[model samples]
Target: MVINLAMKILIGIPFVFGLLVYKLRTRHLSTFNAIENFLRSQNNLMPISYSYSDIKKMTKGFREKLGEGGYGSVYKGKLRSGRDVAVKILGKNKSNGQDFINEVTTTGRIHHVNIVRLVGYCADMSHCALVYDFMPNGSLEKYLCCKKSGIHSLTWEKKQAITLGVAQGIEYLHRGCDMRILHFDIKPHNILLDDNFTPKISDFGLAKSYSNETSIVTITAARGTIGYVAPELINRGIGAVSYKADVYSFGMLLMEMLSLKKNLIQNTELSSQYFPDWIYDHFNKSKDLEIGDAEELGCEERKITRKMTIVALWCIQMNPVDRPSMSKVMEEKFREKFNLVRGGFYTDEVQGS
Candidate 1:
């Protein structure tokens, strides 16, 4: 009887181990199928795919990390063509890997200059990653708020250009694409600067797409980071959520860009200051705005600063209906360009939108 019992116990061990192995393989296969199905439906717009081994070789065994954020750790990598790329290996999957699908589908079809391009991707079960052109300047957040003492402040011209670049990028997401993409997150941290300082919007993991005809979309919960999320998103009664939510976020970003330079040195600011309210009190007067560099802005520079400030205020209005559409917001830029051709400054008319 003892010999028979031992034989049965040894057989059960292998049977249970085999069963676990089979279940693990099946789980991985299911995830692979889900990713594959999404890619298959995207026509030919999807970026290149890399195997797990290729990822290791390109990233040099993940030796050089570029940065880390909510999504995952990004490592500097090189493509076969000798071009540099940033590979973001996503964190372990706790859900169905919906964020991976969201990013691939959202950015794969976009061909805008202001939006970041997805060069390739990997969906190797637990080792999924995204590849993109490495922005030499990194994120705009590095420059803003003077995170470190030695980091130089951006010039007014460059600051305005970044503001306009981000505006155009958000505008493209709202109007340029077949489906309106509402980038729920539009903070400075997500804005990447190339070697030329041209801002490219990145990290579309939290983005949502709706038909251009979708004026007011529904969601189960509010999206976007805490500081930048629109009022209507959190409270249903605030207003119907739409592309306007992105406008609200862009407005908040503009506020940060404007106030960051003054934040460190200015001692007169109120305790627990909300920038919009503080800036509003000081609006209409260039010196009162107190945008650093001794508040001694040149004529043209002052006009650009005020132009963006006006746009920013318009964006964060309490009611979504009151906020200007990106189309209306961007329309003023065309007029400003026309004025420049006629030797006129952007001027106060930029306030109309």
Candidate 2:
């Protein structure tokens, strides 16, 4: 009888522990869900929350994929209102949820022509996604870098307009906002164009925000694409970290637009060669900016190209302090004065000596 009692107790002990474990797990999950709900409700201007089911319905079962990146895949979807939207379904493998939060918070309050509009987002457990206004013309890279057939179709005027639009957008982020927002990733791929070719800045996954009083922000890790990342970001010893990093990125992008070539060609023997050096040399030698179909370019086109080139050079200065503030770059007087045709001595104006 004692032996039988011992066997029964052993079986009961295993069952009891299993029951406790299951209950504990259930309670923890409930607490987690409650906290998440509270946080979601706290965002005053938060974007509309969509459920996982809603995302699936809106996306029509991921029917059309727009593109894919390190973040995740983007699919073309339609809202119930019959409006089109681009749904970015974040990858499940992302270790941290910071990028998802960053994009939503950074873009939610911003309302500008040059900035991409964040329609809404989904944070249903492990399934996360972001919805944006569908860009009809797609990314600027498709026009400038790829689709060689359409390169010439983007006239110098359109290119200049796109560059100006991007600058204005960055300027808004830097000064127009309640806090300064630094776009760590600024490249051709991030600039989207509408049906009318209006450029809007997108992809704020790597962006950072700081108060006006803050001069230098501590960077935990290097941010931005390789070719476009500022020298200061790669090596803090080079210069202080500030909005100037974005300026460097914009400069690299501007150079790419002018040169009509990829800034960094991978796995090539000439990878060591930097294109900015060629830009300076070309300027000094009075060589034509190797804009494709240069013979077809009119006088105004040349003027715009020269002005953009000069501004780009100033932005990419080795020292962060040397770069002009975005506000200064957008000033009317500065724009008018710099637009004048100088005899291949545009550097003098850029140097401001």
Candidate 3:
């Protein structure tokens, strides 16, 4: 009798656990279905929905992979109208579809020359994807950091143009939009370029929105690339969370463009690490910047480099309050007045202006 009772108890335990698992799975599916339905209802203005089969057809069975990142893999595809597009396939193992939802909702409403346009999306069960205009030049990281292999031939003027365009896009997100959007990730990898070398801000998975009534938004934790993350986000002692975090990232990006080196260095001599500090020291002492092959640079190129360096230095100030706003950074008056002197100093007239 005792042996029979013990066997029955074990059987009942498995049965109860199975029932609980089934109920949890059903709840999850119900919630997902509701969110998917809501997204589909709002598809007219934003991105149109595509079935999983349609995504497969567009990507040609994932034949041509453009790249892969922390989120998922991107493939190069062609639309029915023969237009080129890049399709991003989100990984299925994600904890939830929050990243997918965040990207779709945030990028759908934004329309700007410097911001990448979301053509469409796919939210089929277990398969999520986003479609965007094909950027021929890919990301800005290749142009700045990969120039050693002679792949990128961008001149200083073009680099400056890209910087200005990206700044304008960020300014629009911060001030022009109905709600202030904070781009948690603002690195070179997120900046896509078109055939004409025009820079467009891409990747909104980590983006967050706040209303004008709130100046400081609370974040559960730090959300950005390590090298580019603002000191404030990493350590609350630095300052409160604000749009200035994006400014700091942009400053780091600008410095990378000027120096043509990756900010994070590993397996290198101790003295060579922390390139930004070295750059600041050089600038303070009126020393020549260590850009590769200085003799090959023209006078105009030198001037542009100097202007960008000074602006980047100001943008990367330790205190968020000391950093200039994106609007001020985009001011034509400031650019027009900037005149770099031979001694790595600017004219007093420009400063006063």
* Tens-digit per-residue lDDT, 175-240, candidate 1: 898998888999999999999999999998888888988687888998898878998888889788
Q: Which ten residues in a row have the lowest lDDT in candidate 1?
A: 336-345
Give one digit per residue, the lDDT tens place, for model 3 in 168-242.
999898898888998989988999999998999999988999996777879989999977888788788878889
Decide which is better by TM-score, 2 or 3: 3
Q: lDDT of each structure?
A: 0.78, 0.78, 0.78
Model 2 pairs whose backbones collide: none
Model 2, position 197: C-alpha lDDT score: 94
Task: Evaluate model 3: give its TM-score.
Answer: 0.83
Q: In model 2, which runs have C-alpha deviations exceeding 4 angstroms?
A: 1-38, 147-152, 260-271, 277-289, 332-353
lDDT of 2: 0.78
Candidate 3 Cα errors over 4 Å, as ranges: 1-34, 37-44, 260-288, 332-353
Model 2: weakest 10-residue lDDT segment is 339-348
